[model samples]
Target: LRINDPGIDLGVAAALYSSRLEQPLDSDAVYIGEVGLGGEVRPVSFVESRLKEAEKMGFKQAYLPSPNLPDSAQKKKIALLLSPV
Candidate 1:
């Protein structure tokens, strides 16, 4: 499920991981942090848009880093995973 492409972005990686996780990313939610060398989840750009897209797609949850989360989104119907970087 590796998105190893020249135009690879966090969204691509997240989509791949979500598909592997069997979450049906078309209407599911997922996020990729910085992606450390050790495979740790780090903070990524545009947290708000990611969450918003998930919600718009009818996804009831999300996986994201705690550091990059928005205060307003913390209380949404979505689930947030405070992953370690």
Candidate 2:
């Protein structure tokens, strides 16, 4: 749980971690989003690039904000979990 990147957004990651403490997250899934104080997940910038990188790195899924989803994501073959902030 030690984060190395200060610039990395962790709102959604924190929520996921807290919610899934009893169960581990999927190893092949990448999570990306900002969390609001009210626990809503918000979109981040460069979502397409991030998803592409995750796909290239062999990730099978992603959890991101709905607003961050790219139109071309359907072609990437990665499962997406979208939430609203």
Candidate 3:
């Protein structure tokens, strides 16, 4: 899971570590957000596109910022974990 983009994905990294230490994370879940230095999850741009792409690839859940949620995404089957930083 190498990300070539310049944007940071701290939330995903933390989730991966958690998965490694505890029970494995849901295979159907996709985590998308940035974790700040103070350990806060932050919103990113183009959230709708990201979730749509994840759904297209068969992901059943997405962890993202609450403020970034799109109305269109609610119509999809993907469940959202809206975090507030």
Candidate 4:
């Protein structure tokens, strides 16, 4: 779960929380944008390479917004889970 704390950057928060909560963040690095009031995790640009990097680093899954899924990578060999805000 994401908490919207203006003082904390979502990227750092997610990473730290993932570590603290022992979540499956794995080697998947995040490129989180600004956090929203409703605890929404805003999206950045093309995250395909990010996903690929995560997969390359032994991470098999990615969690991001549905619209962020690259069109060309829609059928690629990777695990991308969509979480609605």
Better of 1 and 3 by lDDT: 3
User: How many clashes in each candidate?
Assistant: 1, 1, 0, 0
Q: How accurate is candidate 2 locally (lDDT)?
A: 0.64
Candidate 4 local lDDT, 1-85, one digit each (tens): 7764432355566777778988856453444344667867666554666666656666544556555656654545666443332
Q: Estimate candidate 1's alpha-carbon lDDT, on a 0 to 1 scale.
A: 0.57
**TM values, all candidates:** 0.52, 0.64, 0.69, 0.50
Cα lDDT for residue 56, model 1? Answer: 71
List the candidates ranked by lDDT, beginning with the highest.
3, 2, 1, 4
After TM-score superposition, the amount by which residue 12's alpha carbon in candidate 4 deviates from its true location, in angstroms, is 3.4
Compared to the true structure, candidate 4 yields what TM-score?
A: 0.50
Better of 2 and 4 by TM-score: 2
lDDT of each: 0.57, 0.64, 0.67, 0.56
Q: Candidate 2, clashing residue pairs?
A: 11-35
Worst 10 residues of 4 by lDDT: 26-35
Root-mean-square deviation of candidate 4:
6.4
Model 2 per-residue lDDT tens digits across residues 44-68: 7777777778778888777777776
> In model 1, how large is the Cα lDDT of residue 76?
65
Off by over 4 Å in 3: 1-11, 72-85
Model 3 per-residue lDDT tens digits across residues 1-85:
7876422475467567888899777788777777768766777887777877877888776767667676654645445444433
In model 1, the Cα lDDT at residue 40 comes to 60
> Runs in model 1 with CA error above 4 Å?
1-28, 72-85
Task: Please report the TM-score between candidate 2 and the true structure.
Answer: 0.64
